[model samples]
Each structure stands twice: as structure tokens, then as C-alpha cells.
Target: MPKNAKKKRTQNYKKQIGQVPGALIYTGAKEGNKLHLHVFDYNNEDYKEGDLDSVEEAFRFKDSETVTWFNLNGLNFVNEIETIGNHYKLHPLILEDIVNTSQRPKIDTYQDYIFIVLKMMYYDDSEKIISEQVSLVLGKNYVLTFQEAEGDVFNSVRQRIKTKKGRIRSEGADYLLYALIDAIVDHYYAIIETMGNKIEDLEDDLFTGLTQEEIAQQIQNLKREVLKIRRAIFPLREIINRLEKNENGLIKEKTTHFFRDVYDHVIQVTETLDIYREMIWSLMDMYMTTISNKMNEVMKVLTIIATIFIPLTFIAGIYGMNFANMPELQYKYGYYIVWIVMIVVLVGMLVYFKRKKWL
Candidate 1:
């Protein structure tokens, strides 16, 4: 089996293992996902941003009138995560999902707050797609975002909050949640656009005659990237749909429309992904056919050469026999005659093959 197929099998096997529900397990953070926090407290009149050194400091703003957005940059520090969870009265399962990092995009509503998990995707400088889990816990006057890494796709949302550029400053915590979710969904467009360009480049290479190995490797990589994006985006549609149709007062009526817009965008992304996947499958088939045709051409030439040599070999074998009286062997010019005959036969076969268009 292929490497990707083997990886898929291993992942599936891992998923099949049972884990205790609501168990607190800290799956270590990915590289660069250091422990850090960025707290944003804002209202219609005032906005404050702080880089926090401890999770305890974030608890002070939990009951404050100002809407606080605690952006935790990493989940590897189990103590800090547990401290914040205890302070906010988060459900054990909520903390579990936050630390697990492999949970699917989902939303779970509790008595006083809502918990959401999503995957944030972006392309690095090397044009490789990286996905990280982002969990949001929305409370009465606060929204806590847990990220797997220090960097995120939420920089635009952060800028808007700091600059007071949009309704983010004037809105409530739900709007901030919408802004963060919207930022993540919007980043999908950039990734899809990148994949589109890569598919086009691969198509160009395929037609312009890249080596079979190069084209095959590119097609496999492209397919894997597309599958990754699909896994991230497909479930998000249902999550956004649930948010849009939310009857809980946690999501305001006005903000549901924004969630609806995100739902539409997710649908668009999925459709585009399906198209790209089909193109990749077609490209793979085209590559295989091209390689097969090349092999057939090579075999045809070799076959023709072997056919021409068969008769010459037969004539040489007949004269090389140690017969008592071979007439051609007794002739003085027999060797020259045999050479002339062999040359004529070779030329005749070449001419025939040329006329038949099989040369």
C-alpha cells in the first residue's frame, strides 16, 4: 500500500482506541505552540489589551462588566488550563476536549456557557498547510479561546479589536466569537486558492512533459492536502449551521446572520474542494496512461529490432553447421554473398516497417 494509505490506517486504528470520557490528559503542543496568553477587555467605550504571565490573572475579568477575550496560545500547560477551567466552572469534558486537540469541530451548550471546537488552517511560507485546533468557551461576559500554537489565523480579528475598526469593540462577546470564527473560516479561502494554483501548475507540468516520478509525487501530495482540508472544513459546516440556528440567547439574533454567512462560505469551500479532488484523480489517471503509452512505444521499437535479427540469425545458423558438404561453405565468395543478403533483408524489413507506420 501507499504511504498515505498506511498513514490513514494508523490514524484510524488510533481513533478506535477507547479513552475515559472527561479525562484530563494533556497532549503536548505542537512545535512553536508555546504557553502564552493575550487578554483583550473591551466595551463600547474602552478597550484594554494585556499579555498575561499567569492564568490566575485572567480570572479577575470573568465577572467584570467588560467583555474579556482570553486568548490562550498553547494547551500543553495542563496546570494553567485546569486553573482557568476551575475559575470559570468549565465542564470536565470541555477541558478534556480543549486539551485533546484532535476533537472534531463541534459545539456543546451548557447551563451558562457554550463550548466550541474548530480547526484553524493556514499555509506556511513553504506552501504547506498547517492545521491547529482552536477551542472557544463562551460565557456570560467572556470568551476564552484555546489554541494549539502561539501563532494563529486570528491576527486580523486581533487587529480589529485593537484598532476598534469594526463593530467588534461595540459588540458583545458573541460578536467577538463570530469575528474569531469568521477569521478562521476566511483563512480557508486562502488555502483553497493556494491549492487551486498548485493544481493548475501540476496540470501545466503534466501536459508539458514532466517526469513520471515528479508528476506522481505531486499528484499524491496534492491529494493528501486536499483530503486534509476536506477533513477540516466538512464538519465545520454543521457546526456553523448549529450556531446560526441557535435558539440559546448566548448567540444573539443579529450574530446568527454572520454565522449564516460563514455557513455559505464553508459550503463554497467544500464544493471547490470536491472539484479539485476530481481534477487530481483525473490527473493521476492521465499520468498513468501517459506512462503506459511511453512503455508501449519503447516495446514496439525493441520488438521490431528483434524481428529483423531473427532471419539473419537463422541464415547464420544454417551455414555454421558442420555438414560434410555444405555448398555455400565451399564457395569462395559465399561469406560476401551471405553478408550482402543479410544487408538486403535488413533494409527490406526497415522499408516495410516504415510503410506500415510502425517504425
Candidate 2:
């Protein structure tokens, strides 16, 4: 069998294990308890924004001359999603991929539309990294974006469109798609910056003599988070590369340069992640070496004490023998003499150790 067919079979098998056929199963968090739709219709001369109650209402503007951006803020409503897919004539596989939420970043081009899947990442108020899937379906004159939850990383894009601040409002739907993707990519910089700060804090703690187990736990946590970010952003390079060289006419010629810019940003993010991962590994190794050296230092002190007492113990043991006619036992001051000799031997060993710098 061909590679694609085998992979498709595997995916189907996995999905079928606990899923009903033709069912829409949401695989993400339940934060987006309610469904909401925000539409932005614009052209070089006009712009409008509103909330739509149904997917049919959004489709009304699809045939208009202006470009329409349908932003669905939640994915838990499977029925509504299936309705929008049916109205747009979207393939079932694409719909399934959109709701899966665990999809790797990829692109799929069809006859009338181009589908792109990528992650939108951000740092929450507590400085924790959070990620969500953002899927874009680009048609001739409309761009449909399905987000995992109500909130998004597209506020800057919205501001630019509302204020007419950039060429976004002047360009076609392809440009709008680029603008939204760019917004998602730009927030990766913020996540990377947060990771960098964490790495620096870990390095500082390392010098301050933090506990090995504590620092090790922290390093592992940071490493895990970086791996997650890497998984999210690395495949995006290929996705944007395909968009930049798109020949299907779904992406406009003028907008390919904008995607190229986003591609460059993705490269930078990948490189930064690589650097941080290496630094975390180094921190782990440093932690281990410090622990080993501390243990060796303690052992050295113990070994020196044992070395000094060995001969003293031997002398005492020989005198402790209960043999008949022992000369030391017959002496009048044998105990005092043994005491003085042991003290002399101990002091001499201490002097030797101090001279050798082993103390």
C-alpha cells in the first residue's frame, strides 16, 4: 500500500476506536462553553463588523464582492460546526482535523479552498504558557477561522483591520488570512521571551547553590515546556513555506511576501527554542556535577579522619591484648605513656594533613 493510504487507515482506526462515524468530537478544554461568531467584511473602500447568530447568516456575505472573515470563537458546538462545514462544502476529514485539537501543523489544498492548521500560543496572567489550535480555511473571497476557545491571539489583527492601520483592509481575503496567521506567529515571540526569562532565573539559582533535586525538577519542567513549544512551532516552517510558494491561486501573489516574513519569524522562534533546550540540558549536567563534587568533598573529610585514627586504634588494640607478661602491663605508668604516644601520633598526622592541604 502507498504511504498516504496506510497513514489514512491508521488515523481512521484510531478515530474509530472510541468514536461514532460522522460525529464531531471536541478534543480540547471545555473553556469555550458557548459558541460565538464574529464576522469582518471589508474591501479597499468599506468595512463592517458584527456578530452572527448562525452559520447561515455568515454565508450570506460569502458571495459579496468584499472579503469576509468568519471567526468562530468556540468548537464545542459540534452541530453548529457540522452546519458550517455543510454550508461551505467542507470535507469531513477537514472538519474532523479541526476539532481534533491535537493535530500537528500542516496544510491541505483542495479544489476550492486551502486549509491550514497551526497552534496559537500565549502566556497567561500567571506567566504560564498555553496553546490552542487555530485552523484556517481560505476560499476565493472569504477566510474562515475556527479557534479552540472564545479568547484568541488575534487582537492586533482586529485592531489593524478596525483602525485601517495597515494594508490588511486594502488587500483581499488572502491578505486577511496572512494577517491572522501573522498575528498567531507573532505571539510565539512572547512565549519564547517568557521561556528565556525562566532559563535565566534557573541559571541564577544554580549559582546560588540551590538543591540539586529542586533544580533538577525545575530543569525538567522547563525542558518539557520547550519541547511542547518546539512541537507546536517547528512544523509551521513547512506550512508557511508552502503558503509562500503557493501556485493554486488561493494565496495572492502580493501576499506571498508577507508570508515569507512570517516564515522568517518562525525560523527565529525555532532557533531560540533550540538554544534554550541546549541550555536546559547543560543546567542538568551542571547540577549533577555539583552534587557529585559535594559528595566527594564529604568523603574526603571522612577518609582523613579514618586515616588519622587507624594507627592509634592499632596501638590501643595491641595493648588491649590479655597475654601474660606483657611489658606495658607491667610498667608503672603504661596508661599515661600510651596516652601521650597516641596524642603525639594524632598531632603529627594532623600536621601532615595540613601541610598536604587535605584538611
Candidate 3:
């Protein structure tokens, strides 16, 4: 198509894009709970911090020149979140995406701001399980990050920003965005490391002769964790890749390097996950083989015992029959001879099985 024709089709394209799910839209937070808001504005030499009590308060302290980061810790307050959308002039669709927490990790560049929805995932030490949610919103000099709950992997980045000991204090908001992303990717490393350790422990336990019930339960647990980890990390690789390859003005060229670093981290996470998956599969196979081998040994022993007893039972049955013509019953030495014969038969069967390598 010619350039003029493409220009004429812009409206139609926009309409099509609109029809796609969560395109350039932010979903408002869920209702019935409080959302924590934090604002940090900083430059090379000075900064101001504030705890936002309302959307009005959040907007009142904005600075166009300095990098401002608004961290929304909880998404349960619907009214306040709407106030935020109004204050920031976020598109209604973007607001909708924010409220819909199941959105895929994606990047949408609007006229005024860049909307990014990504899963923030980490393991809670207290709970010992991975948790995740969609985090979103970015603008020229400001970043608005929303999460499902109060705590996340961003604590370390927050500390660095607060102390002004790193480049975060001097860089643009885009770099801060990179820092936020990098911190989350770093957590993926930790999660994978924990999984590696758990897998190792499981392998050792399997080798040490676990019960069938125990092995079955452990396989189930390990596979469940692997699936969870896969869900968290797989699409994240695409997220990082998209960010790195993004040509939008929202992600500056200098920040693409940081995004590239995140991409590498995601790759590492995925590769590690693949290895762990294979390891878990091998462990399951080992468990089955071990159980089958044990059963085979038990059957071999039982068969040998039955074979030795077969002849002894036949001899004893014939002798105990109530036939008056039985020659063995009339002899006094018959009982002693039968005892010797039974002992010899048992010993012979043991030697035979041993020779056949079936014992």
C-alpha cells in the first residue's frame, strides 16, 4: 500500500486494535481494601518523599523535571484507583487492564504514556509458595506501579533509591523502570536457585529408599512447583524480549541495554527450569524402577521358598495317608530319614537359585 493509503487506514487500525483485549487500557483496582501509595521524586542532588493518602495528594506533588516513582502496593481501593486514572489522564482501557489482574505480560504505548503489564512474582518465606500479579503503568518522567498486595521484589531497589547510593538517583524515570524490572528478574534467579536446592534434596531422598507413598507425593509436589515456575517465567521472557526490541519513545535507547540484561536473566531462568524439569522426570522414573526392582526381588524369594516346600509337602502328604500298605509308616527310621530329606531339599533349592543368579 502507498503511504497515503496507509495514513487513511489509521482510524480503522485503531478500531481493530481497540477490539483486542486490554489494548492500551488500565484496569482499576478491586474494591473493599485499602491501596498503599508511595511517591519518590529524586535527582542527582536532591529528592522529596511522600506517602500518598489519596489520588489528589499523589497528583499535587508531581514534578515534570524530576523522576517520580509512584508505587501502589495494594489494588483493593477502587475509588482511589479511579482518582489516580483521572489525575494521570490514563486511558479508560488502561484503567480496565489494571483492574483485570489476569492480563498477560504486555507492553502498550499510548499517546501520553506507556502501559506495561507484567507479573511480579516471588516466594514468600513464611508461606513457602510463589505469588504473582500484574504490575502496570509508565509515563514520560513518572512511573506508576500497581500490585495485588503490599510486598514485592522491589524492596532492594527502593532501598537503593532512598539512599541515593546508585545510578537510580541520577538516571531518568526510564532507568528507574529498568531497575524495577531488573529487581524482579533478579528474584527469578532466587526462585530458580531455591528450586534447584529442593530438587537436589529430592534426588537424595529418592536415592535413600523412600516409601512408594512418599515418593509419589514428592513427585507430585515437585511437578506442581515446576509448573508454577514455568508459568511465571515463560511469558516473562517474551516480555523482556519485547522491551528490549521496543522502538517506542517510552523506552529510551539507553535503557534498552538494561532490558537486554533482563532478557538474559529470563533466558537463564528458563534454561534452569528446563533442566529441573528433566531432573524431576528422571527422578520419577528412578522411583518407579526402584519399586519394581524391590517387588521383583520379593517375588524371587517367595518363588524359591515355594519351590523348596513343594517336594517336602508331597513327601509329608504321602506318608501321612491312612493306607495300611504304606511301607514308610512301618519303618522306625522313616521319620528321621524324612527330616534329613526335607533339610537337603531346602539347601539344594537355595544353591540352585544362587547358581541361577535369581536370589
- In the order shown, what is each candidate's alpha-carbon RMSD? 3.2, 6.4, 10.2
TM-score list, all predictions: 0.90, 0.87, 0.86
Per-residue lDDT tens digits of candidate 2, residues 26-145?
776564478889899988787899998888898798789998999887877778888899989999888988887877899998889999998888888987777889999999999999
Error of 3 at 80 (Å): 1.5
Could you give me the TM-score of model 3 versus the true structure? 0.86
Which digits, one per residue and each the tens of the lDDT, describe model 1 over residues 1-359? 77556443324224325767776676643645578888999898888998998888888899899999998877777778888998899988899889887778889988789899988899999988888889998887899999877678888888888788978888889898998888998999999899999888888877886745777888899999999889988998878877777766888999898888888999999999999999999999988988888899999999999999999999899988969788888889999999999999999999999999998
- Which ten residues in a row are the worst by lDDT in model 2? 6-15
Which regions of candidate 1 are displaced past 4 Å?
1-20, 28-33, 322-324
**Runs off by more than 4 Å, candidate 3:** 1-33
TM-score of 2: 0.87
Query: Between 2 and 3, whose lDDT is larger?
Result: 2
lDDT of each: 0.86, 0.86, 0.76
Error of 1 at 104 (Å): 1.2
**Residue 287: error of model 2 in Å?**
2.1
